[model samples]
Target: MSKMDKKRMKYAAKPGLMAALDIGSSKIACLIAQPFEDGTIEVVGVGHQVSKGMRSGNIVDMTALELGVSATIEAAEQLAKENVRDVVLCTAGGAPESKLIAFDVAIAGHEIGDGDLRRALDPTWLYARQNEDRRIIQTLPVGFSINGTPVRDPRRLYGEKLGVNMHVITQASSAVRNLESCAARCQLDIESHVVAPYAAGLATLVEDEKNLGCICIDMGGGTTSIAVFKEGEVIYTAVIPLGGNHVTNDIARGLSTPVSHAERMKTLYGGCFVTGSDSHETIKVPLIGEDDSEENQVPRATLADIIRSRIDEIFEMIAQNIKDSGVDPNIGRVVLTGGASQLAGVRRCAADILARQVRRGRPAALRGLPEAATGPSFSAAVGLLHYALAERQQTSFTSLYSKEMPSSRFGRIGQWLRDNI
Candidate 1:
């Protein structure tokens, strides 16, 4: 059967709510959305809580992570007044790697159809499968060149050789298994897994920026990741094990304050650039366990200095990674997302360090998205919604296929326990 025919036969018209869960090092967030006929996702519910049991995107404490996940899901369900059995999850913990694989298949002057496309894609899947220790999460067709001519839709065209460029994103197997285990413990099924930076780029980037080439930097609590986009598809990604929490830690250590107080000071008085009055501006910092006292005062300029040093270091690291990855020099713009991007003066710092145009990107406003949720921090969650919408509109040829896995007896035993218990 033709691929389109098979797709139609396999799935029926059962449109319903789409749930997206973003499990990050700093927070656990869930967004419940319903796609309309017009291709827009109306967010019906949103929930987020302070992250626990996860460190640097890895689950350090399973029970603690499960409790956080459950609480976040319950809040979202309460807001939506509906429950979800499955969710599209966003992950940053898996040491994700992106590769562009170029392959060609001989079409023998025949009309391009499902068979031709499938043949072209088979090798890409094979390459992903060869990496036994990795879990393939995203397989995106970057573009197609038919007999040296570029075309977006190659079906029905006649060519001797059809060449395809596919961008494959893979993550560590252990990270994925841990996330899946956490969801299973909560009685939730994972519909699909998306890389965090990829989702953020999808939610916030415009078509023009993507086509023209751009970099998306997602600064979470425990990790800062980058996604490079060219021709409207992600071509490269890298992550650093440092983020806003590190800066907070530095402040806590430097200023002899508590972590919680350091976070508060970072949010309120944090800036990469210092003004003349900063030296004279004294901010009251309360001790973690002590009451308000006169000795707990520090100059705001000192705080800015600490923040600027760390932020500058982050940008320098990002620039070096981009250079090392050999990202296209034509990528002249950098879009910064995630909670850390909200800090004052980050844009200018990134621009000066990365030597690119920098702008803070927030999730695109959609129906029922409150003003509070329309910030850079929520970009990944919102991008999950956008991914679902794009998936819904995809033709059979463009759909992402999950990697093949052998059914394990241990998996069956675990399933039986969950079902029976």
Candidate 2:
């Protein structure tokens, strides 16, 4: 039996409706999309709600988590005026672990093709076996080098042995359970879950940026995720326990204000850098126990200083992670995404602290999504659609072998088509 023959026999098409759920520390967002004719996706419905069960990207309470997910999914489903029955979850809020693992195979001098590639990947199934305290969530390919020559894809590469550079990301089993439990509470099913940072990278990054070198920093409310890419592959990824919400918390503690007020002030007036002008710029701050009209005057410079300090600290940590990941001058620039990346002067602050050119990346270049879905803050959500598309396209051709079929048949036919076209 030939590999191609087996693939044709076992292939199945995926359903059209794709539901994406992004559980960020700041919020729980759900999106339902349908792929369009132009290789783009359109959002049919969307749901978003502030997250409650998670803290710093980890689940703190399952009860609170259940309510949060319920509320968010309800709102999204209501807005779209549709009943959202299930979703494909986005994996961002967790430990954010990424590691490299590989497998080797002896080909017995047999020809290698797409089916062979699928067979080589069979070992990866071992990582799927989960136990207590752990869940394998992502299996991203870094590269495929056959006999020392790096190949973008080894589907048709004839080689004696196949070597794969794989990036595996995992998170706590408890966290996964909490999310699944919450989804169940909200009347939804978990079709699948993808790493949030990787999804965001797909939505915001271009082919060249990923192929050459680029770093993606998703600074949400509770955690900041960093992913490095080179040659269209993820080299490293990490998540920090700090984000915009932490800065807001710092301000609330320092100024003795409520979280709601602090968040309002941060969103409306917060800045990361200050000059002489900010010193004289007095902003009205609400007093905790005052009437509707009661407020106090505070220096904008003070607010900027507080924000800058925390943001700089985060960049320092990111630089350290980049160093640990072996990313140097080769990865020249950084792309900032997520909700917090929308804050004023964040890119400048990132550039100054990381000593790299930082740009606020939005999901601008994709097809079929509305402008509302194209912002840097919605990168992860938009990327989910892309992930679902890629997943649906994946096929296992390992058994594509027949006694009467020859590998040369496919090669000759492919060549003939290429020449004729």
Candidate 3:
């Protein structure tokens, strides 16, 4: 074989199956990825189940939660026809908390390189990581100033002192409990747990949006999560415990229908921003234990208004979060995603409420993705891979073995050491 062919083979050695689990309030999705010999990712397994035992992103019942997780995993395993070992999960619990902490350190008169910045921030991370009842999922660098000038990388620049603004997204203890117990029951291992908004942003937001300024709002079944990025750094994040489920409940109660039927009507006919002439048409919604012909006919505009009311409340809450974080001053655009985001007019409604330029956001991008994942709904699952790849790249660049699984799986030597030593 030629040298290039041999090099390609060497790179293909570590290509293994990576799975994504999006356990939301409304649904649970499992997507397993396999890297082909030609370096393409093929979706070998897919499983999705209606979520249960979760309330607004928190696990309220463990027994039901375990059964649900196991069932989903079993289906995915059956589809993949393999017993997968590791999976990455998404958590919107308690709305992953975001706090900005700044640290100023003297560089001892040395020019700051990537190593220098890392050295200076190591203690800051230790401080944040220590003495907390929470788990830190993402420690994103919002920005840095060397001396008096702002810098993006801030590495290899001369400076007497380096100051950094870091945003830490944290998960609550209950989140850990629900995910851990459920995964244990399912006999699956969680490689990492990431904030839903952050992961979703990774899948949907473009590089320019991150580098410039953009906000990612993930409207899921249980909660609405917001992550703000400036210059490609997440500056703020917050979770609101209201999602599409609330809308379904409202419809169920307001229209006197079952929750299941209400959900069906919502997905098939839900809209946040109603247009003119909505009253000219009517939709047939089945009541509890009723035939189709006996269904209730209601103005489509009324349903849109109901969906909008709850969605408005959710957006108003998120707006306050961004303002409170002092991130809106820098944000220039917005991206919306999640299961609830699939609703008609959601993008438009969000834009009107936030009063900013808005667009539907999907998962940002992946190395080897296909058309199956093109929808806006798959943002979180696709983003998990991006987050892992970014983390891997950072670690691998810092290590002596720069080429060993820098963007995906680690080499055997590294994995062995991580597991054993």
Candidate 4:
């Protein structure tokens, strides 16, 4: 064989590599991993950078965001000693919305098959077309029924009708396009796009929590994303525009300190609840735009009060959003993951407000994962890696419907039958 051809063969024999980029309001993280035969992943490289030109998970400065993304990707590639062309990305912006869509196809007493499942799911394409301004990012089949009787796997079941309840997640087209544009500038092709909260839940929630019912809340710098899981699938997802940054801003304004100092103070001394020691403990707050020698001594209780008010407000909104989602707020425990979840007393405050069992969540340990990256701040990024791998094992109806379908309606049906039968 030619030398170039021999090199290609050698490279092809190696296991494929996967990369995931988590773009958040406050930070950007990249991970590169290789999957093993034992259903585990070994992370080879990791990189993170302070986010720029992004606000509330939306790109506001394309050039700045592009630079940040490129740097982060380069750092990861350098560490792994491998370059990747494609990456799976997760987003917390774009005003993501979720709806449960029911679709059915007439079976006429025939046994349900893959073609029948495809037919049942085809209508979601029409639904997407009807909503021109939004793009469907995820389509999860929560359940299937044959002739109105639910079945775990409808294939091969005899029924006159086959139906599916699809949990469809969509984001504004502008938001999705902006993200795509930024990634394109970074010379990266998006393998898939996942919602931030869904990715967080996948990384942090245990199997029982997902199978029973659980809420995963990922608190980032500028947005708090939420995912509700039931029956081992994500049934609902949401993003709130308030996050850790808001708390920092509150501290800055209340203490008249620079944003940097305010963030430091919140990280070191802030708490959602005040203790008796708070009255005795004091923090030195530097006045904004002032010399280091000019500062005010403030009791810890003052900082705690400011942090408590904002944290309480956030949890209250979370509580109300859960109630509005129509899911049983009491159904399962709550898992809190993300940077803001690490603050003192946040978990207890969430439990008190939501009236559910709440626990701080971190990503599952992976091979070669660094100690610093094991915290809640990195949960979404780690979850993106998990989602990218798991996604390959499952079929994405949305992809088939939107990208792979034939132009002609009859041609689509024929192709589906040809593939399935």
Against the true structure, whose lDDT is highest? 4
After best superposition, candidate 2 residue 60: deviation in angstroms?
2.7
Candidate 3 residue-wise lDDT at 209: 92
Backbone clash numbers for all candidates listed: 0, 11, 8, 0
Error of 4 at 58 (Å): 1.9
* lDDT values for all models: 0.79, 0.70, 0.70, 0.81
On residues 1-421, what C-alpha lDDT tens digit does candidate 4 reach at each position? 5432232233222237888899999999999998877778899889899999789887899888888888888777767877776788897999888877677878899877677676677643544253446666666778888889988778788988878888877777678778877887676777777899999998999999999999999999999989999888899999998999999999999999999999999998888877876778888999998999999999998898899999899889988888888877567999999999999999999989989899999999999888878999899889988876775544434433434432211112211111111
The order by descending TM-score is: 4, 1, 2, 3
How well does candidate 2 match the true structure in TM-score terms? 0.84
How do the candidates rank by lDDT, highest first? 4, 1, 2, 3
> Which stretches in model 1 have alpha-carbon errors above 4 Å?
1-15, 123-128, 287-291, 395-397, 400-421
Q: Model 1 over residues 250-294: C-alpha lDDT tens digits?
A: 989888888998999899888887788676898877766666673
Runs off by more than 4 Å, candidate 4: 1-15, 395-421
lDDT of 3 by residue, 203-318 (tens): 88888998888899988888989877777766777889998899999999888888988899898888886667665678887887676667888888888888889988998888
Residue 263 of model 1: what lDDT? 95
Best by TM-score: 4
Higher lDDT: candidate 3 or 4?
Answer: 4
Q: Which residue pairs of candidate 4 clash?
A: none
